[model samples]
Target chain A: MGEGLRGSIETTGLTMIYRSGKVEVPAIREINLTVGPGEFVAIMGPSGCGKSTLLHLLGGLVRPTRGQVLIDGIDIAKLSDAERTAVRREKVGYIFQRFNLLPNISARANIELAKRIHGNGHANLYKDDHILALLGIKEKIGFRPTELSGGEQQRVAIARAVINQPSILLADEPTGNLDSHNSRLVLTLLQDLNQRLGQTIVMITHDSEAASMANHVIEMRDGRILARTHHFVYEPEFEGLF
Target chain B: MTHSLVAANILSRPTRTLISILAVGTGVILMLIIGGITTGTLNDYLNRTMSVGADFILQPSGSTVFYAFSSAALPIKLADKLRETPGVGAVAPVLAKFSSADFGLVFGIDLATYDQFPGRLEILEGRNSLQGNEVIVDDLYAMSHKVSPGMTVEILGRKFTISAICRRGSVVRVFVPLPTLQQMNGTEDKVTIMFIKAAPGADVESVFRELHRAYPGLALVRTTDPSVLLADTRMPGLKEFRLTVVTVSMLISFMVILLAMYTTIFERTREIGILKSMGASKAFIVGLILRESVIISLLGIAFGVGASLIIRKLITTAFPTLQVDMTFVEVLRGSLLGLLGGTLGALYPAYKAARMDPVQALSYE
Candidate 1:
């Protein structure tokens, strides 16, 4: 996104079936979707609607039972676990609902883990501090995760997710564990990141308030997409938005 | 950053990590000192015997070099015959006796003949004469017993005056007249051993051959080489003792490291899941765990080496005859083995953590 690099993502006939002791449970039905480069999409659904599973498939966390997922025009569903892991490290950055920060390390260390996994050694690059300051978490870098509040921890997780400047970010319930004040704050930060960096973001949420912040809101029910609605929140600074 | 990432997790549980280190250290110390003293004492005795400058030792057949187990009363006439043999320069008869009270061996010898060798007894603090009812004690024995010259002491239930404090490292710490010891033991014409020296500029091999031929029933042992003395088949259980010590020591490190790392992986399941979700490879996770283990092992090895050195010093002070060899090579062998055992013990746990399913691990409460 920084250099208008490719960020196109697509899935065809995505299907998932869970088997437990010979009992078949269909978690996802056939679905086809495409996201243009630099698009900000929010998926809204009820519990057990397979939104999380879809996010996992997009991130190459699990193999799809049927169908293929393509990131930047490369089909990740055809890759092995190790290959998919490599793709995830280089291309997709995931933010979880729980904000999985390593408790034993400082906030900076939690964010730096992403850079280390990206094989950046300990250099931190030229943009790491800039991203932390952009997220308003530069002051809490020295504090351990346990010393930080829930909202602060989630902000650190966000910083970690985008530190590598990945092409795509797949977030599951980014605001599910936060209060209204913190939820709005996190949503505003996500929107700011999307508009300022032209980064592709696919976030899952249950609140309509959170969904309204995205350029496009997708409604899902019973493992299928029910509707696709555009918000049309056009800002002059985001003129080249996809 | 990677170093601190692994170190922070280990430092978080200081008690568990320290216990693991101490357990490994204790194992290494046990292996080095225990195995060292066994061979140390044996080599020390052999070296002292070689220092006597005796070309060969004549003893009863199949007798151990140590006199405690041997009371073979060979005729004192063996010395005159050994002296008459060609290539023999001097022959001194020794009536060896073990004094349980002093934990030392007492040698009864004729001063004129004993002084003919290169390692003649040198009295450090008193007159070197050995007359009726006179005894000579080495420096260590004199210092430990607090007995000086002219102090009458009861040895073998008989009273005798301490006439001299001789230099240490001699074949025996206490010495008296040969006839006096032989008369007291009721063996008037018998001696335990004879120290024979080859004539200067004579062929030692020829002297040994003539001695062996003349004393076929007696044990003629060459004292010039330590390996020859150590190669005696009568030294029972030395190898087995060393092996047992090494096995027990390695087992301690192996079991402690295995249990500690096995428990560590179980406790950090969620952390493993997070690392995996962050796109860390199996090799990366394994490397992290091994790095922490290596640090712990190095610390343990340092502590073990230091403690062994101190313990060796203490042992030598407490018992002068006991030697504890802690050469650099031996210490290196011990530390390396300790590290190897600890590293091997962590392999299974590291593999298990690498193979964990990220989803399952993350969901693990």
Candidate 2:
């Protein structure tokens, strides 16, 4: 793990309740969790398990009804909507199950949009072609999302997520829409990114094989943590892995 | 990258983009064409009136630039009195009437007396004299009405022989004998206005003041100062009429843009959600929408300007006597107003898109 103080997170009694008129439905109950910097954590759960909701909370996509969400040392739960958005832009990158690539723009444009949002629109600190080559998508950057396959779209989405070299990545089912062969390829890339960049990654998945790639595995049910498991994967160069 | 996104979004819906462009273009066209016609007609009238080389015009109190609207209220004796003034060089009495057939003013003047001015009618064809039951027409009106010397045409509901075809740029297109028009209108010995010239080396300002003092009850207007002639007080409801045209044109662009952008935001809800997840702020979203609208407005303005120029050509071709002048300042005003309306129209849609719930928007199918 990188020796950086960024990407550390902790939630103290984090709770979220949805209200529709007089009806109050709790999407997530009181939850306590902590993640250190440079950690690769996988959240495993079934549908309706609030795993996606938790990912959204970690990414600052929604405000919690109660409790605190701390990133590094700042409590984001107390920040205004604009402040939270700023934190998200500066620190968090998200990957969705459907790949969520804008259908009308080219793959390179999608990735560049992330850089623009992070206020590095005209900078060239991190080369994008190198990242696309690492993700095995350098040749397909000119095509729109609809012109690419599901696997190619997911690769572009991952490129967009990490384009700014954010401190944290919150991915909801990174391979849910891929075949088994593409799924393994995506998982291997995610693992390589986590190991090489030391970016704190929180991925949600239903496949055990995909979860096995993470350093830590967490299981959740009914919005509550059921189990926390720790494991290690063999470290090897990415030249022949895929 | 944001620019690419905006371009892709606009290009993706070709029909909607085109409709929006046409709407904005239509608004600009309305403003330019209507404004051009109003300004052109007024300037044409004022120029021709000034071209008569008259130092001052004497009319009844509260007379406007539009001589057709005025009655024969000034007595013909006023012309003799004006001619007798110390600085007055000459006075020509004109009884003006609106000719519906020609869509212009018809002037009645005594040929011998009207020949005293510098802009005296120079006959281009046939006899130069104008007498009872005889009419004189300018070259433009003569060609447009397809009449020449000795051709009989109707004027003031009476048939009169075309005695001559004069050069263009006269004060009026058609001319008749003063006694004939006076007998037809039962306004004998009373004329609509009197054109007065200053004697050589006479101070025009001093002459103007003398005339004003001599005729306290009448309205004496200096023909040299265009500003004085075009003053709002001199032209009733002209400013309001122009404002009405501009407001209506702006409203068209605003409403069309508002509807176009409103529908666009709803269609791109999921896309906006993706942007939000990518950490785009509300300001960024708003900027994106506004930028797209601005681009559309620019395209519309270019199209409108081109189309307005063509329409102007077509109008002038169809009616040679009509004038439509579109100055650069007028075009710029229309373009700026169109852009403003379009930008304002996108505000609500931009706000709605920026305020959308990211979670709900993401899940929207």
Candidate 3:
């Protein structure tokens, strides 16, 4: 883990309620959770489990009805909407399941958007051959999103998310639309990024196999955390005396 | 990403944008053509009606009802006396007579001295000779009466030959010899009015005072001043009618432009939203739309001005009497009016475009 990984994100008694006229429906209720920086965490839940809603709150895309979202000891709920958006733009990068890349711009331009939004000095800082070579998409930089395959588009989306070198990455079903092979490829890319760059990743997925790859797996039912399993893979070595 | 690219993108949707621009352009063209025609006619009418060459008009003062009805008249000796007055340059004695059959006034003037104030009368036939009871008739009167240059016409029981045809129009005048008019009126040393001229830079007021002192019996009516002549003649509500027509036309044109611009903005809502989502500022969007509108309007203005020039030439050639002077200032006024119409038309659309919210706009599809 990097030195910055000492701090993590925490949600304290978070509650989100949707109001329609006189009716009040709860999307999430009294959720408490902690995600360590640089840790690959997967949130698993069925539909209507508020997995995406929770991700939205953590990313500051939506405001919570109550409680606080803390990132590195700072409360995001206390900030204004514009300020929250700025914080999210600068600190959190999102990779959507559908690969929400602007259709008109090329693959390289998709990554350029993040740098422009964050007011970075170097627009082409991430346009280096190494980043494209790392993603195995160096040859497809000039291709538009429509020209690329589904897996290629997702790789570009991932590249766009990491181009800013954000402290935390929030992805909603990053591989939900892909085949098994493409899904494995995307997952391996996420795992490799976590191990090599110490990049934090919080992903929402339905597949248990995908969840098993994470350092921590969180399951939710009815907007409440049902179970959390922390696992560390251990490598076994042979003893010569034995 | 760059201003040029952004502008190019905004202009790339040629069909939709051109339609909006054409709406503005059509309105501007209509305004320019109508304004040009009306201004040209008004100027010509003013120049024609107000003849300022005649320095003075002699009329009876208090008891005299009109110049034609007056029994009192100025003697011919007053012309010689007015010539000797200070600042008086030249004096031409005129004998005024009326022809009841034509309801027109005749000024039997001295052919030798009539060159001082000809009053747009260009002799197209025989010379300006006042010999043998000959008369010069305006072209309008000659054409109406079917009288040629050598034809004889009896007026007030005196036989006279039409020596020449003067310029055309309803203010058709006939010039008979002064001695023949005296013989017809059966009076000697009798004249109607003395037309006078003053040297350049000579104050007409001082000249008028001296003329009035010299000829106390004659009224020193200063008809030479353009403003006084125009003021004295009532225009029979023609100006009001013209103003009403022009104002209503402009109002209709303005309404058309307003509606066109409104429709254009409403139709381009998606495009505007896309631009806003692309991080274009409110001012930038407004400026782009306004620039497009203004450019189209100016093009239309140029076309209208060019067309008007051709029309003016055609009209002038067809009717030589109609003097149409399309001045630079008038063309400038038309162009500026076009620009104003374009700006006014784009105001509402620009405001709507500027106030669009980026998020709502992006999701408008």
Query: Which candidate should be chosen as best, given DockQ against the real structure?
Result: 2
Model 3 Cα lDDT, one tens digit per residue, B1-365? 22332344335556644554454445444544555565555444344323425567665554221244454267787777677778987777777677777655676777776666646357787766766588888776776677888899987677888888877542226778888888778766787666677766788889888878876875666764545534433233545764564455345434544665566556556546434332334565677567655665665566667776777788666654445666787667656766676667767777777676543443355
Roughly what TM-score does model 2 have, to 2 decimal places? 0.96
lDDT of 2 by residue, A13-120 (tens): 989888999999787788899988889999987788789988888888899999889887778899888898999998899999999999999998998899999998
The alpha-carbon lDDT assigned to residue A235 of candidate 1 equals 55
Candidate 1 chain A: minimum summed lDDT over ten consecutive residues — where? A233-242
Q: In model 1, which regions exceed 4 Å deviation?
A: A1-6, A13-26, A29-31, A73-78, A122-124, A221-242, B58-77, B93-112, B126-135, B150-163, B176-193, B212-221, B232-236
Model 2 chain B scores worst on lDDT over the 10 consecutive residues at B225-234
Model 2 misplacement above 4 A? A1-3, A232-242
Off by over 4 Å in 3: A1-8, A121-129, A195-198, A231-242, B2-15, B27-199, B204-365
lDDT of 3 by residue, A129-241 (tens): 55667788889978888999899999888887877677788888998888878888888888887887677789998766677679998889989998887872322331111
Clashing pairs in 1: none
lDDT of 1: 0.85
Q: Estimate each model's TM-score.
A: 0.87, 0.96, 0.57
> Which 10-residue span in candidate 3 chain B carries the lowest summed lDDT?
B1-10
Kindly report the interface RMSD of candidate 3, rounded to 1 decimal: 5.5
Q: Highest TM-score: which candidate?
A: 2
lDDT string, candidate 1, B43-65, tens digits: 76787777788999888987777
Candidate 2: tens digits of C-alpha lDDT, residues B1-365? 99999999999999999998998999899999999999998999999899888988888989898877899998898788888898999899999999877778999999888888888998999898899899999999888889999999998789999999999998888999999999998999999999899999999999999989988999888888888788787799999999999999889889999999999999999999999988899999999999989999888989898999999999988888888989999999999998998899999999999999999999989
